[model samples]
Target: LEEETEIASWTENGGLFVGTNAERLAEYKRFAETGKYFGIESHVLSPSEVKEVHPLLRIDDIYGGVYSPGDGTIDPTSVCNAYAKASRKFGGGVYENVGVSGIEVEDYLTAGSAPGRRIKAVLTSCGKRIETPTVVNACGAWANEIAAMVGAQIPLKAMKHAMVLTEPIAGMHSGLPNVRDHDLSVYLKTQGDSMAIGGYEQNPEFWPDVDPGFAFGLFELDYDTFGQNLAGHMQRCPVIEETGIKSTVCGPESFTPDHKPLMGPHPGLRGLFHACGFNSMGLMLGGGVGRELTKWILTGSPEVDLFSFDCARFHPESVASSRWVRDRTHESYAKTYAIVFPHDEALAGRGSRKSALYDELKSRGSKEPLDYDLYGACAESGLAFWLVDQGAYEEGAWRLGEADHPDIPKHQSHEYLDLVEGELTFDWPASHATVAEECRAAREGVAIFDQSYFGKFYLSGPEADEAVQYLCGADIEGKRAGSVTYTPLCNSRGGVEADLTVTKLQDSAGSNYYYFAAGGNTATKDLAWIRKVLEDQNFKAQIEDQSEAMTLISVQGPSSRRLLQSLTHSDMSDESLPFSGAKHLEIAGHPLLVLRLTFVGELGFELHTPAESAVEVYRAVQEAGAKLSQLEGIPVRDAGYRAIDSLSAEKNLRHWHADLSNRDTPLEAGIGFTVLSKLKRTGS
Candidate 1:
């Protein structure tokens, strides 16, 4: 353009203002190096290459490095004028020297369930209150100060930096490309006709303290400490030495504790948005950040995944442990231009893989099915197991041993049993309500829960009851037809063996029955002993093991009563038979034991049916209660069976090994009258 110009002027040195950054060049190098450590498959310029590629002066410490041909520089004063002209042409608001005093924050709260909050406007120093539905705070280093007015902690801080510009040294290809590299932590190259060089190496601690009042005076450089650092860089990079000491400038950088930009809502504050704290990457990532910032102001999060920068995640506690994150962030301000990362997310450091349990659980369902809960467990089942296994035996023994139930294994290697305990100790009214709602669902309609491991027993032929009665030490002579007996089976040595429920059957013959025990494997093991005893006695009873053939599902809800009442043609109510009582009914050619036993304390019935019919029965019950609970809005009480069992035991409803035992005598165990007198007559 100078060749064709009639009037033209050229100056090697130009007025430059990073406005907010003086250049913490060393910090910029670190930030850039970390990215190399964990590299991105993108291109950036290197300092050594910058010296060699441009035919300016003698080069030194030259090595394979980052290069970008499109890099250039400018006079901030001229650029500001250009921007002002563009704004005037576009009719955009331009406020200079006028800073924001107070932001008039108004939240137009439309009452919601919890009232999701938002920000309405930001009033500036010009007494101009920008009225809008959404507000964005792009005040850079002062973001936190402004954000606090809107009820948000911005996780932002201010930093000062310095950059050096060398004297004019004309050479072929007069202006060399702007270059950046991390090897020596410096970016060196051109500034118009002069070598506009900079170093992010200003030792923040060694330099004279900067007065916050004189922030924009970039011409005031850190003369002493920065001079020493600049000398060393010039010694290594010969190009900077050829055109050394043009001028020095300083500016501020905004940062989050994590060294990343903060760009999101002001958390608890409604409609208030943020796009500040770029450290020094603001200009580099500006276009992307700006677009997202606008989107984020409208929506809580930008489409480009900005979760990492949301200030809410930092809170006041998380980053409190490490001061490095804060310090490093400040060091990498405008003057530094440091590589923001250390290792290649690919190569520089460590690597890991998922645990076996997590792999299995994740693959088991469409998504990870086992809910250990991130809020509560904060990890996978394996992680939980690790914590539990650490002091399992010791903690278990301490708490349970004090309660007199030493049956829990001791805190020894072999004795340490793996158990996942999640019940909260404190009371929650909502939890109780959930339990009641579950029970209510069961009673009114059908609710099928996990009873895959429920213990069951099957007995057949003429003398099944004889063997059962002898094994249980209970008299079945008066066990009413179609009735079930709550019997306490015992070991011959006289301790309560297992708590069993035996249902009676006539079947066109004399009375016969089988026992179903309470404890999971305990009942099965006890029944195994009964079969062995029958064989030892040479008894003619036939024992068919039915534990696997059946899975006892309790359809105990109000719906349970209605469905069973319709299925069996029998009415079940508190008046007809008490909670512990039972009845046999025929449903579509299948024989079922309908018992009024509820673990949840709900008014419901349990249908003891074959495992094959479980799905069918479950569907039928679910269908019956579909209109009652699962329909979503029906107001109903629920009783969580698990909670009921725990709470019931606490309330002393039915004892497991206690009331039905010979270990402490029936009276001591709390149930004495259930023992029959006829058993004394049959002493043989």
Candidate 2:
């Protein structure tokens, strides 16, 4: 942009991040290592070295710091003007002070004869109608409102952010680098002749109802909230105390639930795209975002892994609730500078969506003993389980053991207090032993897991098989009924778009259908990709989202067959339902589609049943397993996501969004076996 527009909107004064605590310093050291891996220039500085970079900082209390010479600040207003000028030079018209009143949408058929919605036009408040087939909703704080006009939704909310400016100090200059005291959630930079200080507070003020005409508007000085950071600012820069306060700037900034920007095409709409919800980093990420969005608009997909920022990542049900969006957004904003733990889960917006077994799972955490020996053992061991929102559905997590710290208060029903009081560290947690036992059960005896959060979908019609063969990297062609194929769906660049399993099934009428099971969090994203491919190819296939309609229960271990065989009349032999085979059977008097697949590298069966019957079926399985446990003297346990992670990691399994993503190809991910030899030879 700088070269094209010839605008000087950036200041390359470098940046410094200082830590006052050991933990923060350790975090900085790890970040420096990561920067090295990425070939980014960064230096871990000592107190004296940090003083050399910025003499104004009182580094006496600082433990350590990291300095990156490439880090700098951009003037947002100037950058926007430059982009507008560049757009005009490229023959694009720029409009300002115009508000979107409504969006006109119409039903249309794709090239493949599939039903879809397209933008017909956009109506503006200035009595002008723009005739366009695509509309990008880039209205930062008003993004949700604009989306609502088109019957779409994006999970974003605007919150008030404040920054204070001090009268010029004698030694302050433009050359001083931008400095951040992340431990104190405060940042400082030189703004011309003065110093500007800003912070992220624990409790931020939300603007639920932003005025329609509040563009580029500032709110009155929030002294109460802005004052909280003044002490930290003074301690870091002692000269700030002597200088008089110049002015305070407070404005609304849009934030998302996970603190990542909302980008990519809307899943339900054909031509509607999202490029907002930057969480106060718009100025820094704007250029990159603009480039990626442009590429996506022209080519149907972005060039890199953007699933983390995809607007479809959140379940519609969770984002539809204003209360849930507000709570999660608040949590995301507060943790802007907090240390990120690998295993940490959000505490807000719990139970937004739940499986049929949600209540039963919560009951297992109770202190009161039930009829089952498992419950009795849990009570004795002070084991308390908690559920986390996975793909919006409440999935069970590791059970907590007795609190390592006795001073922590205990709840009457469960031990959530332990989670609140226990310090989160990089080392093993108190629940490690409990998770080990669960893993043991899965490896030895028997373990049942409620995996209802898996995203389920169906593709049917005469062209279903053709679509699958084209989209999947595996050789799924000519696969017989009851065959399950684990495949990687790749993009045009051969990057893994999704890692999932596709099972071929036949209806009573002999029509073929395909069942797709994907990671819970990537359900919407995967669906969007499938629909896009189908439409682009003009394939005569119909896609259905059954994620919320079906529930998945997994039974694994060496004794799994014996335990399941005792409950049903269907054949449980390997010859009848071999590995990678799927069949519809009557299990515990309920009809279920069972697949012989294992993510934990064990003999396992995944039973996909109707969501309404999941609780009863799960209870029956638990009861039968308990009876078998008593007879065989082998433990039968209920496992959670943590145990699943441990067992899968033991087998070196790759998890989506963690070990595998859209940025990696199957060959690079060590899963080249899934790709067809023909495609590899042809370099397709």
Candidate 3:
């Protein structure tokens, strides 16, 4: 950008992140390892070595630090101007001081039975209508407002961020690198002869309402709130204690519920895209974001695996709630500089969404009935089942122990007291043994998992078969109805966009419909991808998102078929409902669509039941498991996600976002069998 635009927008002053404790220092070491894998230049420094790099540090209590020589600061204003100038040079118009008043959309009839909406024009505040087929909502803090005009939403909120500049120091220079004391949540940046100091507060104030004419606006610095960071700044850099304050700058910055930027096409509207909600890292990530977003706009997909930052990651209902957005945004902002443990779960805005069998699962292992008012009580009780966010719903993950475990406290007066803390760690947690037990059950006896969070969808119409064949890498040409094919939805470059199962089912009227089961977190993203493909190809297929209406209960192990047969009147023989086959069965007196498959390398069945009947079906399964346990001496256990991970890992089952991503091809990930033989021969 600097070579082409000739804009001096960046200063290569390097950056340093220092740790104050051993745990944080260990985290730095792990980060350095990751940086090495990515071919990034990074060095782990001791306290004395850190001081050598930056002499201003008070390293007596500091453990260590990590320094990146290539990490530097950029001038946001200059970069923005450079982008505008470069865009104009490329025959792209750069409009400024123009606010979008409304988005014009028209409902168009498609070859399919359902109709779709398309962007027509954009109404501006200047009373001029800009006729365009696409509009990018890169409006920063006001992005949600722009999305609202098109009847779409993004989970973003604006918060007041304040920083202070100290008086010119006697020996400060621009060559000094920026310093970050993450433990203290304070940072120092060189500003000519002075320094700019800022920090992320534990409880930042949210700006729910922003004035329409508040562009480039500043708010009065709240000394009371800013004082929390000011003390840390002085403590980290003692020289700041003697230096006088020059000025305080407070402004509104946008943030998201998960702290990741929202970048993708709008799931609901065609030709509408989102590129905002950077959570204060816009300036740092703008260049890459711009490059990738340009590719996404030109082509139908991006090169990188951006599922983590996809705009459709959040549920529309969750983003629509103002209180949910504020609470989670505050938590996300406060943890900007905190160590991210592998098992860390967000504590805010929970309990709002739950599966149908939430209560049934909670009551099974608890010593006493848990209270609904106690937040995270199940996590600390005798059951020790930790509930985690699975998209919009709370799903149980790991169990520390059973009711009879010695680690659990026997007595408790207050529900919140005697809670087990520090369960979120990078090392082996106390639940390791419990998870191993659950894995044993899945490998030996029967193990049941409440997989209600799995995303379910249906695709049927005149072109349903063609759409599936075109989108999937596997050859589904001759697969009969009721056959399940585990395939990867590949992009044009043969990258694995989504790894899931497609079950072919025929209705009573003899119309073929395909059922899709995907990861809960990637539901919206996968759905949007399918819709985009359908629109681009003009396929007359009707897609329905049944994620909220259906619940999935997985039963796996050597005895899984026997256990399921006891509960249902369906034929248990391989010839009747063979492996990788679907059947409509009556389980526990409730209708269910059962699919025979396994992620844990065992015989398993996935019961797809209505949400309302999930609790009853789960209860019936547990009761049958108890009876089978007495007869066989091999217990049927209730498994959590942790156990699922262990079981799947043993089988080398690839997870969508973790083991496999959009950056990898099915062949490279050791799943070449899922790809078509012709494509492999052609090297496509």
lDDT of 2 at 676: 57
Looking at model 1, residue 363 earns an lDDT score of 39
Candidate 3 yields a Cα-based lDDT of 0.79
For candidate 1, the per-residue lDDT at 121 reads: 65
- Judge candidate 1 against the unseen true structure and give its global Cα lDDT, from 0 to 1: 0.48
- List, residue by residue over 1-684, the lDDT tens digit for candidate 1: 223322222333211111112122334343346656765322332444444565443334443344333344544555445545655666777767776666665543221112234555666677888776566777776665677676556556666656776776656244455544433455555555665555555344212232435435553675664665566456544556555575676676666544577766554455566778786667556557777776655533355434455554343322332232333343333224433221101110000112212222233331211222111111222111232233432443343222323465554543213322222112332234444544444444444443433456655545566666676656776566556666666554444545666666556555465546344424333444455456545555645556556645466545566555655556576667666677766565577667776665566566676766654554454444455555544333222234345445654666553234334544456655555454466862
lDDT of each: 0.48, 0.79, 0.79
**For model 2, what is the alpha-carbon lDDT of residue 530?**
93
Candidate 2 structure, TM-score to reference: 0.91
List where candidate 2 sits over 4 angstroms from the true fold. Answer: 109-115, 366-417, 420-423, 677-684
Q: For residues 1-684, what per-residue lDDT tens digits would candidate 2 score against the true structure?
A: 889999989998889999998878888989999999989799999999999999999999999899999888788788989999999999998888888899999997765566898889999989999999899999888898899898887889988888988898887788888999988889998787688898887667888888888988899977777776888899899989899989888988889988999999998798899999989889988888899999889987778778778898887777778766777777677778888755555545655666666667767662211111100001111123343322111111112111223443334433343453342555676666777888899999888877777789999877888888888998777789999989999987778889999999989999889999987777878888999999888888868899878988899998988888887888989999999999888766789999999998999999999988887788888888998889888778887667888899999999877787777889898888889574765466
Superposed model 1: Cα runs more than 4 Å off = 1-52, 56-60, 74-90, 106-110, 113-117, 170-174, 205-215, 242-244, 299-303, 307-316, 319-325, 328-684
Cα RMSD for candidates in order: 27.9, 5.7, 5.4
For TM-score, the strongest prediction is: 3
Off by over 4 Å in 3: 366-383, 386-420, 678-684
Compared with the true structure, model 3 gives a TM-score of 0.92
